[model samples]
Target: MPLPNILRYLHREQRFLAVFVVGAALVAGFVKLAGEMQEGDTQALDIAILKALRLPEDPSQLIGPSWLHSAATDLTALGGVTVLTLVSILAVAFLLLLGRFRQALFTAIATGGGAMLSTFLKGLFARPRPEVVPHLVEVTSMSFPSGHSLNSAIIYLTIAVMISRSFEDRKSRIFTITVAALLVLAIGCTRVILGVHFPSDVLGGWTLGAAWALGVGLLAATLQRKHKIEEPDGSIADQSSGPAPDQIGS
Candidate 1:
């Protein structure tokens, strides 16, 4: 093989290895956190964090300005089912319009599958909602793993990964992913501040959600390498004289 080709192959393999290792580590961390929660080892820490977020005089009120509370409520809704579903639908429609059928299909699957997984985990644990503080928002589900945190992380991160592919520069890709991460962080924090979830619940959701997104990314990369999926916009295939796979149906 040519030296340049071999070097490219090595670089690709190294990237795949790094993603796999990070995904595996995230899964392991989630497992450990889950086990600790089951053993009641995280209760004290979770309770303390939840309580600290509330005012000493009134557990019902969050320790911030009135506007901050209102802002948190609105931000938290971004992670709700209604908003996420609408966002997912719009994203898939956009991808389809771009003739990226496989990308749209996978995005739907990733977000939908993540939601189902979140529900299943919540049911499996049957953890009660925090009673140490009054909840600012209404909730009526099990709470070992926060649904908002998990769903938002999965949806936003998956979308970010897909969108980043359209950018040619590393800085643009990093910025996109960073924005998604910040959104996820903000949503998770709001859940705690509103007294809807234990801190450990958000932590569990983040680990698992990130692992799921990484797993999907690995699959997408593998399929792209095998010529089974559309390559990114700026890939070598897009530079060729022939039409790209994603542009076939356009």
Candidate 2:
């Protein structure tokens, strides 16, 4: 079967395509808008405000590096990309152990596909890192969309979705969501606190990440509903009244 046909079949029963197309278009439009933005003076004003707010500029100033390193390592271990790798491996391991090939296949596709989309989008944006001030921590990459923040959203949120499958308590769900959110927020904030990313860079990254992840998530939900990949739940629904202050970062 052709690729489009397969994607349609993968999500055949729902409005995945409509949402993906529209979400992707919006992301593209925002990327263009960010690129066209020439508000350096505005950013300068914000930077002055940031200093006035007495926010710590360096990660070490906010938290010591040795301690922050351990924290980053801890989070890194639990971070999205890491979880994706671990899950893929374990899923394969489980498939081998239990002969659950279908379980392995679908989980791999949803998780793996999301990771790939995140990578592709990162490369496409390739925004340079901020040079407004000397970086507080070492970094080297295009900085338009923060890879850590974007990937954290995809990875953390994906793992949380899978974990919610077995848990049934309200507290359990809330905890999982909180942990995932804090991880994303922390990773993004680390970028700015480390002085590697401007506040706007992080904002653009969060916007793109949110739209991308939500689009993928909604697609995943629609597919699960149509394909019956897993047990049904009131999935991928949101109750937010407005854009999350995801940039509650820098």
Candidate 3:
């Protein structure tokens, strides 16, 4: 689909849509810019930024008391597979309670779809990870599509949307989505901060992941509408919300 149509679909709220469109456009620009540049010094700006902000480089140091970093690490870590699986199960369970079997099934399909797209794009771009600084983390996958960034964003954001329709208060609905966004952002940055992914990789991951998630989400919503499924507006995050496919319909 054209970018304009995609933007229209995502534009449920003008302000948020503006941010998303702008972010995607800017990231796309940078991805292009990054593609043109040869191996150059990246550490100078980073060093200056780090010094100006007085942020610590060590994981332990970054995790002083916010506990969010620690949580983010757990979500983004390779060991996070178990967590992701568990979350997916929770999402399905919620769908089951809401009598949304179709969506429960969609969860699996959507995540796989996102992964496939990420792989395809990574191969298409063939972007290399930055070599200016030493890699503090280990990664073997193609670098253009950050797996960690895409997965978490798809999963968390999907849950957020599912819960949004059920809650009348709006705050309850918004909180779940807010946390989901935080998880996506935190995990993406963690990939960069850990020296495992280039900014472009994370950018591409979010763009591609959100696209897949949104497509699936629309499909799910369409199915729900056609079938007249009335799902309970329960808090999705409090339970086992996992992959976004669960959030697709009903």
Candidate 4:
């Protein structure tokens, strides 16, 4: 093979190695956190963070301005089940309209599986909602790993990875993934601010959700490479310029 081709192969191998390492680290971190929670070792830190987000004079009020409170509430709703479901449906429909049936199916399966995994983890831990501070939002479910944080991270990150596959440039792909990550962070923070979950819960959700998204993306890329699944059509962008679509993973 040519020198350029060998260099390209090495770069691809490095990128895959980096992604696999990150996913593995995230899984390990989540497992450690979960173990600490079970041992009641994280309760002190969780209480401290929750209290610090609230006023000493009034635990009911958050530390920030009233407008920030309202904004958090609105932003947090984006992670709710109804909104996520609608977004998933729209994404699937859009892909189907473009004749990307396999991609649509993959997206559907990823999102659905993530949701089920979130529910299963919550039930398995059976952790209760935070009571260190009064909850600003009404919640009635177990909360070791925040549902909102986990679900939003999975859905948004998965979609972002899929969408980024259409972009042939490194900058565009990085920007797309960065935006999705920020949105996921914002949603997770809102859960803590609203006093509905411990800080650890949000952390666990983020780590596991990110790991799940990365895992599924790697799987899809492997399947595509083996000719078992179709590559994205790159219909979202003009591919007349920039690098080849296969240079980036799905």
* Clashes per candidate, residues 3 or more apart or on different chains: 0, 2, 9, 0
Predictions ranked by lDDT, top down?
4, 1, 3, 2
lDDT of 4: 0.86
Each prediction's whole-model lDDT (CA): 0.86, 0.57, 0.58, 0.86
Task: Compute each candidate's TM-score over C-alphas.
Answer: 0.91, 0.60, 0.62, 0.90
Provide the lowest-lDDT 10-residue window in model 1.
234-243
**lDDT of candidate model 2 versus the reference:** 0.57
TM-score of structure candidate 1: 0.91
- Give per-residue CA lDDT, model 3, range 63-106, as digits (tens): 23566445545657732446656776787788777766655666
Which residue pairs show backbone clashes in model 1?
none
**Candidate 4 steric clashes:** 0
lDDT per residue, candidate 4, 58-111, as tens digits? Answer: 999889787978998999999999999998899888777767677788889999
TM-score for predicted model 2 compared with the true structure: 0.60
Badly placed stretches (over 4 Å) of model 3 are 1-75, 78-82, 166-169, 228-250
Lowest summed lDDT across 10 adjacent residues in model 4 is found at 234-243
Give Cα distance to truth, residue 233, candidate 4, Å: 4.3
Query: In angstroms, how far off is 165's CA in candidate 3?
Result: 3.6
CA displacement after TM-score superposition, residue 113 of candidate 4 (Å): 0.5
In model 2, what is the error at residue 131, expressed in angstroms? 2.0
Candidate 4 residue spans exceeding 4 A from truth: 232-250
